[model samples]
Target: MTSKTTTRGEPAGPSMTYSAIQQPAAMSDAGNVLMNWREWKTLFDCYIIAAGKEKASSREKCALFLHVIGKAGREIFEELDLDDKAKTDYDELVLRFTMHCDPARNVNFERHLFFEIYQGAENLILTQMIRGIKGSYMRERLLAISKLELDDAVSWCRAEEGP
Candidate 1:
C-alpha cells in the first residue's frame, strides 16, 4: 500500500519515504534495535524499489544502500548467524569477490561474481535472493553479483520468511 501525506493542506499522492525495519511503527520508543542481515536485506530491497522508480533517483538511493552496507560491516555479517560450514563458504565467497574487484577487470565481471555467489551458496537467504530475479538479464546479473561456481539446474524456489 502507498503511504499518503498531507502536503499543501491536501493529501499528497504518496510519500517517497519508508521507515527502517528496526524503527517499525509497531515498536515502542526504546533502545536501539538490532537487525539481522536478512532484515537489512529486506530494507535493501525496499530501498532499491524506492530508488528504482523514475519518480525518484535510483542511483542516489542505491548509493545510500552501499553506504549503509559498508557502515554495518562485520555487524551485518555477524547477524547472518550462519553455521560454521556456511560461514566458511561465505568467507570464501567474499574472498573471491575481493580478488575479482580488480580495476583491470570489467565491472561486468564483478557482477558475474555476485551472480555466482547468489546461486552457489547454500544459505537459504542468499538462494532466495537469487530466486527473486525474473528476466534473463536480471538472473544473469544476480549470478554475476558474486560468481560462485555452483551446479546449474538447481531448482528455483520461492524463499519463505518465517514468522
Candidate 2:
C-alpha cells in the first residue's frame, strides 16, 4: 500500500530530518542543515522587519515563520509560546543579523546564508528564493542577496576590500 504525502510534497512521516533535507546530500558539508534551516527562516523574518509592510509586519512574519517551523517539524514555536525570552532572542537575533542591511541606511550580512542554502537546492528552488525576497523594500539588497555566490560571499561582504 502507498502512504499519503503532504500537498507540498513532503512525506507523511514526522517530517524529514535535517540530514534528509539536503538536496544533494553532498551539500551536507555546510554543517547542521537544521541550523541552516533555522537561520534562513530567521533571515527571512529580518527581511520583513526591513520591509516595514503594514499588512505583512514583523508580527505577521513571526506567524509565518511559526507555520514554516511547524511544517519543518521543529518545535520551536511551541517553546516560544511559554518562553518570552526565546521569542525575544529570536527577534533580537534577526534584528542584529540584519541591522546593517537596513533599507533606511546600509547593507550588511549580504544575505549569504540564503544563497548558500539555495546553491544546495535545485535551480528552480533558487529562483523561488529570489522571487520570495522581491517583496522586500530594499530591492537592491534583495537583488544582491539573490545573486550572491556561496563561495564568494565572504569576500563580497568585506568593506575594506578594494574594487
Which ranges of candidate 1 are over 4 A from the true structure?
1-7, 14-35, 51-62, 74-163
Error of 1 at 63 (Å): 2.0
Q: lDDT by residue for model 2 over 43-135, one digit each (tens)?
A: 554544444432564555455545444433234333223345445454653443233223352234445565566556555454554465433
> What would the per-residue lDDT of candidate 1 be over residues 40-118, giving only the tens digit for each residue?
4456556556554323444443334435555444444455454655444533433332333222657888877886776
Error of 1 at 73 (Å): 2.6
Q: What TM-score against the true fold does each predicted structure earn? A: 0.24, 0.24
**For model 2, which pairs clash?**
none
Q: Please give the CA lDDT of all the candidate structures.
A: 0.46, 0.45
